[model samples]
Target: MNAEPPPPAPQWAVPPEGGWTADDLDTLPTLPPHTELIDGSPVFACPQTVFHSRAVSFFSGHLLSSAPPGLEPVARFTIDIDRSNRPEPDVVVVRANAVESLRQTRFPASNVLLAIEVVSNDSVTRDRETKPVKYARAKIPHYWRVENHDGRAVVYVFELEPATGAYTSTGIFHDRMKVSVPFPVDLDLSAIAPRPRAADPQ
Candidate 1:
């Protein structure tokens, strides 16, 4: 008979109470410039490419520029749910007063009204799978995905349904479409797309 496979090796499990403490979080490898600890596992953030960065900048700038009174735009900061689960959404819109308080530390989930992810080729799976589940678990009210490829943006809007711990699809906006939600303003897709630039000569 073949020998038993070492009792099947103990499976790793996420810690109860607090997933990871600050000290344990500090010991993780620091490379690739940006990584987040999700349930004590290191999840690498997608690297900033030109188009990806542009999409983030465009939408962030638009939100900041057009935000109504009391609303503000936040970018690339960890929104801590607990020690083990801190996700740094690409863009977050929260109350202006809350933004001021979060400057001193990680933004609490209560302050987050909307979370946006600008999907890159490398992060599509994590954004669509891991993150949505995490955000849904956290009860974030709204989530948006801005998908870019060959210079176009495809927007997906999801509204969290508290009863089911999932996001119910609200809308899907393609090129040149507008998205209007409960948030203070409407989002025009054209504003988030790449614009024409003068060609470089040889």
Candidate 2:
């Protein structure tokens, strides 16, 4: 006799009223791709455009290579802010010393030095409006938003206002970006231009 085939994963298995937590998310047998738990509900991450991936790759490489001692950049990692908010930033700069203390899959907001978001058409409201407020309230020291405009990458850098727990826009970069806050970083943004894809064979 042939062996039985494995069962397919449940289409919908949200927990009963209380909502999904990080612990519950970990217990899921299989999660859909590009998924994030939002306020105890699962929200699929926005699909990435080719340009988006290239920009992230470029920024990650640049930031990691030049990061100050005891700090490093992490991409596509979840930050546990609270029961209601656990956003996975596109990239985050975190303290090296706290890497071990973070849960196997997620970091606490307190450990994050900076949180970054690469804006997608579908995520403009969330990235530009919603998440910034959340990160600022979480007391993250810095936040960066990257978007392309007029055929060039634009970076909006923000710093936290400790008293208000809000972010103040510090610098906006259109070409070569130079800043000294949290740490000094000098970056060239030319590679952020969207590349042309080869035409498919007819």
Candidate 3:
């Protein structure tokens, strides 16, 4: 007799009356890690690529070092944009005081000064279109979208316009990146490329 195949994995079901809230994200053990809430729905993150991982690290390190006295950089944390939306940007520059608790998994959007997203094959729509609108409407002042261009990182920066509550592109940077809003930032984008490991000592 042939061996039986394993039972299908369990699935998470949405509630009957309404979609998920930001608070539900904290309690849902069945959901995948790094899941985000958008428009009352759960948005799962696709597997990250090598380029995505390297770029996230690059931005986190540089932003942390470059942040001013009252601001700080945090990586892979969700921002509580509202009760219904809690999108996790790749990196966020937030007010230092917002990190009051070590156990906190999410920060309020009001405390976020800048949000950065490293585009992957699966995140193009959210990173390029959806999240920016939400981030701006929430009054997060700065946003950066990093894309892999010809095996190199290119950054597109945006700043929120207070009156209209929307983001306007500040610059598109390749090879190097420099900006002066929400605290000065200057980065060498080329460093995001992987360097060859030194030959093992003979």
Candidate 4:
């Protein structure tokens, strides 16, 4: 007789009372990697694509170089929005002194200068609609949404409106990005990703 198969893995369950807390994100061993907490619920991120990876890298690098000494650029880090929400932005510009430890995983919303989200197919709604509202409400001064358009990057810049507690579109950049707020940011968007070469004629 063939050997019996090993037992199946246990399914992960959430506490029904209030869904997932920010702390549960760190404590849950079985949770998928890059799992984000949104409105007391766990939202999982799909696998990254080449465009997403390249765009994130380009933005992080530019922010790292352009940010002032008091600010630092961090990539793929979670922000402690509140007890229920801890969304990890693709790139964040934060106060250098706000981090308590070298191993700190999350930063308070107040410490963040700018939050960036690079749009992926699976994250369009969250990045375009949901997260922007949350970030604006948290009073994050600046927000940038990067999307791949025909092998190039397009940036949608937003600034928080304090009176309304919402974000207003400051500008939209296609070929290049030049922003004065949230520190001076100037980059050639064309270099965000390596484009495919045209085929040679026979």
Best by lDDT: 3
- Residue pairs that clash (backbone atoms under 3 angstroms), model 4: none
For 6-112, candidate 3 gives per-residue lDDT tens digits of 97653445443567889988887678889999988888888888899999999899878878788889999999988889999999999999999999999999999
TM-score, candidate number 3? 0.91
Q: Candidate 1 has what TM-score?
A: 0.77
Name model 2 segments beyond 4 Å from true.
Answer: 1-15, 101-103, 195-202
Candidate 1 achieves a global lDDT of 0.73
- Summarize candidate 1's per-residue lDDT along 56-149 as a digit string, tens digits: 7877888888778888787876677666787778888877777665335457767777899988777888789988888887788889988975
Specify the poorest-scoring 10-residue window by lDDT in model 3: 8-17
| Candidate 4 C-alpha lDDT tens digits along 1-202 | 9999987663335465877789887777788888889998888888888889999899899888888899989999999988989999999999998878998778998999899999999899999999998998889999999998887889999999888889999999999888889878789999877876899988
lDDT of each: 0.73, 0.83, 0.90, 0.88
Residue 5 miss distance in model 1 (angstroms)? 36
Which 10 residues in a row give candidate 2 its minimum summed lDDT? 8-17
Off by over 4 Å in 4: 1-11, 195-202
Model 2 TM: 0.86
